[model samples]
Target chain A: MATESGTSTRFRSQTADFDAETGLAVDAALAGLDALDIPTTQRRPLASRAWAATWPKIGALALFLLLWQLVVWSGWKPSYVLPGPGKALSEFGSRLGTSHFWDALARTLVRAVEGYALAVVIGVVVGVAVSRSTILRTAVGSFITALQTMPSIVWFPLAILLFKLSESAIMFVVVLGAAPSVANGVIYGVDYVPPLLVRVGRSMGASGFSLYRYVVAPAALPSVLAGLKQGWAFAWRSLMAGELLVIVPGHPSVGADLQNSRELLDTVGVMASMITIFVVGVVVDAAFNTADQRMRVRRGLVAEGTSAVRAARGSRGLGVAGGAVDPVGSSGDGTMPPPADPGAGGGDGGHSGGAG
Target chain B: MTAVRSDTAVRIDGVSRFFGSGAARVQALDNVSLDVRSGEFLCLLGASGCGKSTLLGLITGLDAPTTGTVDTTNRRAGMMFQDSALLPWLTAGGNIEVPLRLRGIRRGERRERVERLLAMVRLAGLADKRPHELSGGMRQRVSLARAFAQEADILCMDEPFGALDAMTRDLLHDELERIWRETGVTVIFVTHDVREAVRLGDRIVLLSSRPGRVAEVFDVDIERPRRIDSARVAELATVVTTRLREEVGRHGH
Candidate 1:
């Protein structure tokens, strides 16, 4: 054995260079470990991944349109009262060229964004308060979840009574509808953080606020994201309901357009406005999904692509895949490594084919 | 309480731990005592319910004994759990940086230390990769690096290689030995496998199950640079295995 260096205050920086013979052995072993690690997937290009994600959604949209056209062909209702897919598309296409249409769309989008932002803030505050205080959790925990299950539209009458038929009226209901889910999400995340992580953090001398900030909070993030996604959906539904009922004369929104089209018996305009609402919901949901998937990838909760649990269990993760490792008795040999699979790295981007 | 030498990294004096109360009382450990010498590799060996991990918990201060004292001289034990519980959000380098950052080390030093630790674990250029991007062995390696990043005098591992396959475990044994030799850190390793204890430890403290107590302590006098499959290691492992089986066999009575 080397001379006993009893104890030191700091960790030494010279493991691989400890002795001439053993140092070389460590290096060779490390080289073999380096070779065994291959890419998680076939490493498809970025365009392929993007295409893979896009094509399925496009196909779904086409199938829906086809079904709508078939329903129109069946003549379930009068042609004037219920327009076909062709008529709705033609109306929608015609509206796209109008500055009036763009203004209404922009106003609706701005309200949605601002209202959702307010809801998130409320949710975070309520969530943190409920999570931090046992009394709050006991008093309001079940109530928060109860509020989530109650239809957001049910809040409109109370919201209008509280704030009148103004922007505040719409925002009040939106916040009420979305904040409960957000708070519950926060509470659930805090409750379920793995105890092992907490122990590891404490063992490393992280305590008090530092433990919560570095360990607990980050561990709770994935759950929090799920909450936020669900919260946004609620806010969207609430905003849509509020817009229809409490439309101010100045604020031209999609919901207000639907109301006007119905009042005027403008069948094409009504179909076009409904289609716009559907598109908005689809787009926002897609954005949330993308955010959730990216976060999951970062945590290794999912593999680089799909099949994370399998990848972890497979030979690529823990086994001797390419070759056996017995380099102990070899003489004067630091084998030049092939770095295992060269193609696993060279391919642009990765196989994030999104289960499309 | 029992007295300890100045060089003793950890001392457990008549430590016993009981869970619940009255008829429900389960004794996890019973008057188990041992001293870990500074910079030595000591293995706590037993079957399940032997309180090997419970003893480790007392040493690390994650738990306290219902009776007796665990004197660690105010030094904490950096523990490695069986599963590589790396924070999913952070990169591999970022996980190592957590302890340093918590200690309020400056940014530049933290970065430098992270690079060094990653390199020490033979995970160079994988600093940006998250836990999922790496394989099972790689995740464990990063976990080991994160443990060292805590800068503790004693590294207490609780079946850290249990999830890994044989080859990966063997690789980590080499990696761990080299790191231990270089750093001179005391290791209070817990494992069920007799061969594993022989492969890595300088000393093995065998404990009995269903109310753990120190059964015997064997000095692993095998020479350095010993392989897991080496004849001397297997021979000692055989002896330890028989003793361990005898202890385990007592439950049938």
Candidate 2:
């Protein structure tokens, strides 16, 4: 590895003979990465993101379990009222093979998925529509915000009355709760899209539906995905609330099962149910977070070494000095290192070359 | 008055743009008339709030002049901005091929055009790289390629290289000269940088700030690929700077 002085010396030598034009060019070449270094404050990777990626959310679970145990041991609440981890695990084991528990879990999962999928489709479509139109944006934007502000649980009663206590009734409440957040996410994403990007799209002859398909949608994806995540939270909460209030004879949703387990003074069963809900939420959230990070990485938003290296390469092409890097070594891809020197300045910068 | 109509690629006749009405009204441009020539590099040099960009917008049909007619027979006009306004989602090649894609060019033709444009801008291997993947200069190069891909006869650039460092800007000036020579396209470049104006333009047109009006027009008899350090370029830059300073001083700033 080059010493620190060697690196600085190399940079100085590279640009030593540069004219005003070349000096500006070299600076411009490196200008893109002016703010790329991760801030010291953000140097520590967030566990939330890491937990969302790896299947080992077990660490957090262990901490949570310890906290629960502490709460019980410390007599924060009556042991009988707030069951300990051991009681909850025992309760979970007892219900593992039971048909009621399996059916409740399946039913809740299916309804949540249904509500979530529906919300994503409608939310993205309506969101794009509202965001694109001035009148619609002004008129419906506030309404969507208001809907998000209202708790999904509040819609449970109205939805039951409207759909008359069917599966669709519960779904209606879930959809109402989740769709608004998703729509808002998409709307906000589109709203935040840089005006310059939109202008670029227009110059490229993108207009009408093509404009959104090509520019607006992709640009708004991060926000749309965020909305989807939020939508799921809303959907999950709404489904549980709907199931708790609207009773079905054969089908007991997780929420209803929790209530019934409580009615029978089975605190362990209630704890088990709560744990299941928490686990599912965690899993779904992890999935969304993973997908979002992957997308950002693909878009080069992450401050990974690969990007830093490429940035260094760009400077090299402009005849700026870079610290000596292995010309052909193993890259992150586990293959031969990417082309180290594409012969940028020799000529034919006007022709097809892989250097840039 | 009305000298050699054929020399003009753009005709902004008696153009006046006003915002709001009555007491709250502001006249952005008043009775502005100009003729931008065919295949000539013209710089619209002005200060902030001078409506130089507005004039360019009127020429490009992005916005209409409230009280005048901008008539240009050319059906297509290309525009560049200071921000480099590239589509972050699209790869450099994909962004370059956008105009072709919109025009219903076949996939093969689109690829060919994109490749050619990328080559022209010296950004060949960046086909798959998104805007964020490239450095600022590279992004601007991609933007330049995109503008060229429009195949417009006239190119209107509003401080296209403003955000770039001096070295990159100068390098691009050389690249732009090469491109202009290769393709005989008319250019209307707007910039606040007088040295840039002197270096890049065949004709420099100055606009006074606030309710912008044409102040003076100077023909830059400088040769191609004009060196920034060259005596001629420096002399012209100095003269233009003095004129600009005097104009600004009239506003008591």
Candidate 3:
């Protein structure tokens, strides 16, 4: 009996220790948070995080440019075959100043956006349709996987035959390449969603559309976003491939420019065209990366340093609310133990605790 | 077989659940009969594949017993699981409001009730916080709050706190005891934890593996807010552990 009381007393003091450690951690975190500048209503971390995220990519770009300049100066290949960073930049600027270059760039940009947007819309719709139904998921899922595995360039010949080598034909190829990726993404996202989450939704009486909206869709967002990123890569690559193969008269898309440069053996223009495509791909990838990081940060999955602080704040809030009824001194009934582990008493700590 | 009293909230009579057919056929639950009293905290203790969870699933209307009737008078029943199961996308308050919303509670009233329950779980300020924002213990608390908010007469938990660490599980025990006392709701909790069964249950029912059937049932005379190291809890825990060990031992033999 005396030992039991001693254990309770020790437990109470341990609770106090936890609260104190939490409080100290929170104070330090709040101090660190002073640097974070997270807005009260803001879903995302402060501007500093965004700035930090961009800096590395910017540094990498600078490094790449430096390396390219070095390679050019070293005569790694002939000057025309491999232009220096300075020459490329000058050529890019010269192209930028011309109406012809602008027209070509504009046409390519429009096509890329059109194809990408079409893929996203069709992909998401078809993906969701396929994922939600077992029959569709089973029947078309294999086909979608097959399409995704096959190279986009393979579809260029088929696309030319289908649309008679027109701009619309190129868009069709891009859609074919990207839609499978998007659909597959949605399928995988829905598949991977934590079963606990689905059960929770059911317990809450959410089923059918309400359940999907409230639980499934949001839970699958990160994976769906990943699929969207993959889809974008496919769309961009397919568009470039289609453009190179299908030479349209009186129009100057990047793919067409590449073909023209190659025909004339203007290796500089071919390299320039390739560089433009690479830069665009890099920029799009960076944008998606930023979005993914922001989502994770908002969910508190990343940035573990702030966890104790947030938890401490929650405890403080609890303490303040309970104070009116129980008062501060009586709050030591040891009922609240500063957010300790709920599954601790189970023999093993490795039980399935949360959602997928 | 002991005759079940009429005051039973749950009565499983002559239930036999079989999986597969022919040579592969397996009887998950064979000729099981049990009575769970109204407002009683009954823990269904069993090993993996002992059909404890399958039994709970049948009771919750998620599955059907192949050869028996599960009668609960159509009372609103809520089920919790080993996982907190709180939606990562939903805030604690939002999760709690789900059952209420489903029952067609007015938006204002749902919000008010969710607010009250959040405070009850001591998660008042964290109403706007998502599940991912919560710690493991906090998430389970939110889950418990959500389960209670369902306003069900019978709450079925499948090792609800099984994933938590020792300290948080103990604290939740206190919290659950407080809630159970205040609500007087009937609870059918399932777990493999011997001590947890002793700590929370009014009656502990141990089921044997391979064609699961009731091995033993012990009535715990422990009072509310029972401490982990309480003599009564330890004593009952010892009795149940011994019975469970013997049951498991018989299988190995």
Please list the C-alpha lDDT of all candidates, in the order they appear.
0.76, 0.71, 0.70
Span of 10 residues, lowest total lDDT, candidate 3 chain B: B1-10
lDDT of 3 by residue, A69-123 (tens): 8888887799877777776677766777888877887898999889888888988
Candidate 1, superposed: residue stretches over 4 Å from native: A1-18, A37-39, A132-134, A303-356, B1-5
For lDDT, the strongest prediction is 1
> What does candidate 2's lDDT look like per residue over A155-221, in tens digits?
6668777877788888887788778878887787777666666776776678888988888777777
- After superposing candidate 3, which stretches have Cα over 4 Å from the reference? A1-55, A76-81, A97-102, A125-139, A261-268, A304-356, B1-7, B101-106
Q: Go through the candidates in order and give each one's DockQ.
A: 0.35, 0.18, 0.18
Error of 3 at A152 (Å): 2.0
Candidate 1 residue-wise lDDT, B1-253, digit = tens: 1233257878889999999999999999999888888788999999999998899888888889999999886555788878887776788999999988987899999999999999888898889987756777888889999988888777899999998888889878888987887778789999998999999888999999989999999999997767999999999999999999999999988
Q: After superposition, how far is residue A247 of candidate 2 from its true place, in Å?
A: 1.9
Chain A TM-score of each candidate structure, as shown: 0.80, 0.69, 0.69
> Which stretches of model 2 miss by more than 4 angstroms?
A1-57, A73-83, A93-100, A125-129, A132-140, A304-356, B1-7
Indicate the residue-level lDDT of A270 in model 3: 76
Number of clashes recorded per candidate: 0, 4, 9
Model 3 accuracy (lDDT, Cα):
0.70
**What are the clashing pairs of model 3?**
A194-A356, A341-B168, A342-B164, A343-B163, A343-B164, A343-B165, A344-B164, A344-B165, A344-B166
TM-score of model 3's chain A, to 2 decimals? 0.69
**Number of the candidate with higher lDDT, 1 or 3:** 1
Cα lDDT tens digits for candidate 3, B154-251: 78898988887786677677667555655666789999999999999989889998889988888888855567888888888888888888888877
